[model samples]
Target: MIKIEGFQTILYSLVDVIDSGIHIIDTKGRTIVYNKKMAEIEGMESDEVLGKKIHEIFKFKEETESTLIRALHSGKKTENSKQTYFNNLGQEITTINNTFPIMDQNQRIIGAIEVAKDITNLERLIKDNILNKGDTKYTFDSIIGTSENFLEVIEKSKRSTRTTSSILIVGETGTGKELFAQSIHNGSSRSTHPFISQNCAALPDSLIEGILFGTKKGAFTGSIERPGLFEQAQGGTILLDEINSLNPNLQAKLLRALQERTIRRVGDTKDKKIDVRVIATINEDPIDAIANDHLRKDLYYRLSVVSLFIPPLRERKEDIPLLAQSFIEKFNALFELNIEGISEDVYALFYDYDWPGNVRELEHIIEGAMNLLEPGDTKISPNHLPALFKKKAHLEEAPASKDEDHNKRETQESTLSLDDYIANTEKQYLEKVLKEHGMNISQAAKTLNISRQSLQYRLKKYQVK
Candidate 1:
């Protein structure tokens, strides 16, 4: 008995040196030994806890009892169990505890030793890991492009994410402005927070105001006192899409919100503090919008704290194959098809045609092609592409009516300058895609694989609207 007690004393002495708290309780819940760390954790001296009953030494709520004492009393062992307890000072601390029966030579339970490791830091780290998952899963990997221009825009956006300044994404429709916005949000420290988007053009003036500045219940018909995007996105980001579409009055209100870092509900008297990062997207030139009285110049200057221009798909043709492959893979999963790759001829056609609709268009085309593919087919041929793709005729039919027709064509084309000819060709292509997509700018932009803002800009530039 002397030797056994001595061994336990030495064992507890060693356990006291380690940071983890250790306690040994007999079958009746009487404390046999308590390490120095355990004494410190319970706000008692080692001598005070040496032989006290665990229930008496550590106070616990009656409803939620301690597991270690219960395990000792029940002769059951518990492993790697986590619990949060408040110390005498009411400071909450998290612990990972393991309690097991200490058996004698007869293999019968004698007492139980409880080992508890403070895991407050570990829990914090786990929370951080969960929050960071959003950042890693939706960053540049989601952007998907290999073109130099596209890569440069991504690089700049990545850099911009490190700062808290406002970012204005400028591009024609279907240029993936929101994707870039999301990438930036994911890359930033604010990744854990919400990323809210509001389309400025989609809502009417009254609704847009209520949507952005939320009204109190009974302030207006159907008002339920809901939080606005800014309020909902507190400590996160708010993406104002087609910011140029906001009327001058709303533009002023937005500027005030940006400047004050607070917003009052439409009918409320109190201004709520906000910590939202603003990222605005515009399809039109801000200078032109201001000149044409579409956007307020003051608001433009405030929103354009940091500006990034995404090149149109036509400008970055090198990325077409990469974007096409990404879209093909996405559609394959969505449609449950085995479409493996685009044919060499289809790629050649993709490169030759001016992608007036941009990246969005390419995605739709791939989805359409995937939908058209037969079961077990792994390749998408040019014939699988839409008829509009083949209408250009350079890849199919030879020039009809030989020399005389060629001469007449040359004479008609020569009437316009080289710049004008290119512009006309781009305009004609955009018109065709718009017509093909039933004048739905969003759908047309996606079918063209460009941003809606970029498509809208092209429509204006080509007078297609």
Candidate 2:
């Protein structure tokens, strides 16, 4: 049994701890409850807002624009509607709001409460791209690649511009997947229309649906009838960057849209036709993404109408000189310097080093070295290079110690019994898989094709965390 006062305190504590912003107002529109999260979201103090009316703290264009006010007056609930308004500081704030009218036993509206999820950053990205009129920064000719495999990929991408089919680009991060995507869109016949590129991993699952499929006004509290990315990119191309990170349910919806050539907005009954060309990129192998359950197999088939794989920098080492010179020229214009190029020693270090970050890393390294060049220095030598390259050079040039060599030989010669070796190998594999899945027991178990309990038992037997 709990006292009424204690129960109220418990409720208040729970509300304060909630991740979403919460604000409650009486029938007269005077704010009675303002949680910490709400204060943070609005950039206001609760004490300042406590006795004030909703309109006093927030600047809504109309009374109806305030979901709390609308719910209080109309006795209607609004859920999952997006609201854009100004706080007291005049800073524009965007939130997904759910407002409900608090009614008495007689069914009369007494007060209203609003729960808001902050989505300002995500909203800014959508707004910036939605009205974009087919302007793209990169083209097929802009792509700097001369390697046989990379050139073949570029040629294939150029040929793909003839068709309106979906394209999937598979590559490591910073390997210029979006560059290829923009190039394809520019070369295609639909180059005159809008080109919108959205990273799928940018927003939460709750907001991404409305962003991708659009929303109907009555769908939720403050939701307006807005067009989604697919609608905005109609007759053009919508590039879904890091498509593997998209929610599985959204992937199914994407597949349906791709297959039917139509998309139904969120909370809408009717499907609308769209002529958007979908281009999706994944930082990892699609097959591995599917096997790890990060991507859907059926959706993969739908998206991979034409697939382009960009080779990593290490695999195409011959392009280093061209890429390095290109970056030098770019930096020369930016810094107003006329640095000629890189030296052979620097090129040797670059080739010897495995560029884990791919082309982007090379460009950054060049920029760093150029920034360090003296007034008379025309070339990027080993000394002008960053500390990372210097360290790599030191490690490569250093002679191995006899003690270290002896230990390596001893470890190589030592062997375990057959059963022991098998168990050790199994343990190593389990640890590797666990690390791959971020030590998520259930996902690792699923990948290993074993029951959770069985995996747990093995983990216990091996004392693996």
Candidate 3:
């Protein structure tokens, strides 16, 4: 056995790691154990109850249902009992308890242990309907932009909500494909049903197949009858994110499900009919995807009945201010801060930077800036923004004298061809910019004066970090 100073240390570690609140009492009804989770649920420290009685910690509503006092009296088990009480700070709390007598080897009652589960907020979750909780209800107005290009995509996505046919949304990561999908579902006839989503790139083929089509009992060891995501989304929508990530074999099965409107669970011969509308997304060019054998031509046609391509944020730079303002408003209400807006310098820096992660990255930057605001701060200034932003802006607008002095040393090189020299110079500049930015992708994109997509492509082309 491993040596330790005392067994109390081992017991303390085990109690703190548990999910539920655990409390144990001795035969004398004095508290011998109270864990950290119990403290959080009770809004009191463990020291408050370490050596106290049940009456000293909380006001019990029903002594029989709420306390170990009953177990101490009867020396019998109490299963699934519930209790309600007001904490020291007057916060209403609800919890269910499982209290039972702890007996020693002599079959004599020693103490009682109670496992408490805080169900205060869970009641609200049950009322809101957990099945529909994950589904977003974004409509056409949910997308914020007025540019003609953006408006066109919105109009197409809105039109897609009018039909039950398959849809294929193609865009770079974080281009709001899920937003578009949610809008379509909320506006469709299936609005009252459910909308579920899964990322194909996140799981392996064998597991993904079972999650998509479900499994029957005896299919494998520990397998039981369960409904897959498609079944759960009946009469609604199911988005297969990064559709190209699916293995070819699974792609064939998904195509069959679409064509026949039926799916067979793993190890089950019977086919179950489903009415889930499929919306698939891919970030790469469709033609390239086909050539690379990442997607089958037939499956592509099946899902592209109403294709919607979302343009990256770089293509719609005019919307940056609007998006930033919207994020500021969201955080202002969320954080209860008095921040009004961003400064002009911040706006200029935002325009100069290429958003590689699209709208999502912009939102995160605004959130981070808002979090740094002082209690009395009115608007977000350059100092409030992340350091990466300031560095990128400085590098992009650096003095031209630095480049001028370096160019003076070149003699119109004769050894290298003109195209080769230009290519080499471009490679060296990208590497230098990337090194200066030091993993700050947003800053690097801004410094290069190019879209995040182009920067990534150039980095790959030159084999640079």
Candidate 4:
């Protein structure tokens, strides 16, 4: 049996390792448990906060402003509440907190625990960078595709530049939806004005509300009179990437803003008129998103004044060689190498592979292969490919069987469709990497070269435990 002291030490260690800030206070509001993450978030030592009262360490203008205090008094949970206050160092800190009352069997509150996700840096970035002047890096010429379908899409987009109607660009991940949005922005009369781009998946609904719409001072603790992305992009363009990630309430607000051509800042009653062109992008089909309850039907009608669909890489295999050479030349110039181009065998393997990640995956593979070559290397051979592609190449290059009956038998036994095979392989690879990292989403995502939200989506789709 473990001693009480040893068990307490173990519990403290476990709490310290948690990703969010944890703070537990006694009934009288004396801090009893303050974890390592909390210390980092609040910029104070645990020693300083361990026995101190909440009011002594942090300043709240009113008792109601503190979520932990509210939970303690009301004996109810306060979830996903945003709090902005000054820390011990007098620096403003912002967090989304979930606070709960710890009650005994008798239904009497003993203490309160609060879990906080620090977003001070995110708030600062939104205020400083996102609200600043916006410029684009890619124009129409930067897009590299010559397929007839793609050219038609480009021509339509060019025509779209003549008007100020909102546009919706739909495509799979890495299919350059943003590239098209930027090209449209640069081609339009708004080209000389600011062009701001924001991903809807980047922040929680509560924080994102104040970010999209302007905020008024005295609205909440530490909130300043600041203009949001909409106001910042006035007279220019604003690209809301992955618009379906936004909740219904925000979507309604966005739709209203679009219809009225006016915005009311949070905590302010006056409606301000603005002239801003809205551009929204969805990774999947808008119809699918709408059917799945991810997007609002009304907002869809308002945002899709003009819709552009970008075809994925697999559908346009004719452009594979063109994109491959473009990336090869790009890397050659960037890396200062004299590699001529991809070998015929590599091209054959590329043609056989289903590019699930589309153009971005191709560029990443080419970049990886270029990193392996030296200045004297003549061309990118199959041997220079990444391990994943090398495996696929091996499977594609399986020697033709001389015995017809044996080949027919083998084919009959292995009859899984290409889609099924790729799906199974991807699921297995995701599971392997997740297990290696002990299911830490951020670490697993970093190792997979994808975003955390993307990893989470794959996990949910595959039902990976």
Candidate 5:
């Protein structure tokens, strides 16, 4: 038999080495052991917390919120519960905690233990990664705004962090839907696991299927056994960006995946169980998407159990300066420029203009301005703006009368050479169709009513990348 002292040494060793914070309290609510990790997380010295009464420290917090307190009073186990509060040092803390009552050989409650994993840095990383880089990234803090409408979405997302539910993020391009998805995942209980996203509109149906659900060995030439996005995201989150671009067949398959919590490799007969939370995003309104048959009704009902819309930049113009400052700071590091800020003229012009490309357009404009600035330049002025802005401003000043339409028609007629016009018009049509389908060549070709080969020839002919 192992000696009691040796056994005690092993138990204490196990507690000290683990990554999660550990706090143990006796039956009388007096702290027995506060491990190194726990001391670090609570921002206190072991001497300060050990032997202190937990009831005295957490008496006013919450009955259900504090797992240790609940276990102390009710003699019940609590698992994976989220709690947020300030520590003794006044540092705000958020953690997912698991607490249980220590039991004796006779099944009597002897003490209580609390285990917590801190994700403070993870949340910060998620926000920091999204600064002006346009990467598929975000957390609630990554999103910048104080507008009432914008903050409401943040509040809604904050509330969502408390549960595990499939969500649908609706927003136009550049409105930061992916950022919100990242924030939601980071704040969730599964924050320690992988967070993956697939752009549904970016590939053909056959390729998308293999990429998302994996492919079996010998299923097809060059196809190796693999775990698709759903399997890869087991115990975590998967974000399907542009979900409406998925074909009806894939939509049906996705519906089953969500309902059953299982997925099968592309050519495998066996099904694999997976624990994954999906967050789907769409640029269009759900009703509009369903009405157009672009998104399935059943899929909509399932994925949209929780839905959030990111207000467009035009709707939240008050946030422009804040967003611009963030972009300035970001680009300063990226371009190695020390430009301090934007000028009053540039700010005024930004307000007067309509941002067609939304926040993304603003970023591009700032980047363009930076490109023209000298090392000595400290601020972005109107003169540093793209020449197009000056031309557009002049045009905006002109009154829109019948004469304006006549002038527009005259300009359109005068600008096109017969051959150039045909080539330009064809290119415009192809580009629009390609963009509409998220650059899926097969889908774009089908919408254009042209053979894939024919569309290929035209694309090569026009040199469309």
Candidate 6:
């Protein structure tokens, strides 16, 4: 009898440490014992939960109609099944429950003991995996690109999602800064929470304050007690695009909110604490913005705790083909076109021309090309490209003027030999690439797919900086 009792005690002790929530209910539907995890899921202490009626303690509606209770009363065992219930704190929880009737040696039912494994996280993982496999309509996966630079940005952003640090994205306009901010939020632990954005440049100085840190009722002509972006983004992320556009006064307020993690409504004296991850984007040089008094220096420092710079399309020409291919595939699926690929001349044209508008311009050009191509067209030729490219090609094809006229004509005509023309084009392209790579020879060479020594030879031959 002593050995049997010790074995029963060991079994009960093991049940307490099993991670899942375990509960034992008497025949009258009263909770006789609640494990530590069961109390945690209900957001309560074991002392307050134990010996209380299961329904009254947890305040769970389903406990009253629990299959475990019914099975115990009917003198049968309840098999494993899945169910969803709200805890004491009213958070939805999913559980895979197994319940069995407590019985004597003769198998007479007395009560029931339930072991419920919380499966909320598991459910979310499955759902996220499925959603990730689909169209990716509103997420980071939709930001299409396969360039090394773009892939590096994606990898860094993925790392950022694992933390709660403030992220500052610095890039020129139309560089998809906001898209990256949203992508980071979607990949974060707060994915299920709100991801709010406010463009500082879009609001007037007179209205920006109220829009961000909302006003209270009677605070102004039309003011009412309203939650601001900070409040709405609690437990999530708030993306402040064009953060440098905010005036000094608003910048001070924003800085305080970020530092203190609290905000005060327009008419409220009390500060309300908030839990929000801030992600700010700036199109201008942050240092220049501060020096020019367009942005507050202190605010700029705070926002740039983790800064990421996105290179423009002109800077990463090697990525042009990859970005173009991605855009072509996207448009083909969207428009149901079977256009195969870009022609060799079209690819060369893209390589030759500068993309002033960055990736956004590239996407538009691809869409236009897809529209021009027919169903049976295997390749999108240079003619199918925009008028600008065709114009450039025509300029490249024009014959050289005679030597007598060359001196009288423009400088471009004076040195219009095939070698000189090629040299000039190469110089223009190389100079742009060099500037984009911050004058780093190895990086520029790698971007151009040329040897560093080869790039140096060209640089010396053309007298390029």
- Estimate the overall C-alpha local distance difference test score of candidate 4: 0.86
Candidate 6 is scored at a TM of 0.56
Q: Each model's TM-score? A: 0.58, 0.79, 0.60, 0.72, 0.57, 0.56
Model 2 whole-model lDDT (C-alpha atoms) = 0.87
lDDT of 1 by residue, 225-310 (tens): 66777887889888898998999889999999999999988878899999999999998666567779988877877887888888
lDDT, candidates in the order shown: 0.78, 0.87, 0.81, 0.86, 0.80, 0.75
> Whole-model lDDT for model 1 versus the true structure?
0.78
Stretches of candidate 6 above 4 Å error? 1-148, 388-465
Worst 10 residues of 4 by lDDT: 392-401
lDDT of 5 at 256: 94
**Regions of candidate 5 where Cα sits further than 4 Å from its true position:** 1-137, 392-465
lDDT, candidate 6, equals 0.75
What is the TM-score (0 to 1) of candidate 3?
0.60
Q: Candidates 1 and 4: which is better by TM-score?
A: 4
- Candidate 2 regions exceeding 4 Å error are 1-10, 26-28, 63-65, 70-76, 103-110, 130-134, 387-399, 402-465
Q: Cα lDDT for residue 14, model 5?
A: 92
lDDT of 6 by residue, 234-256 (tens): 89888888988888888999999
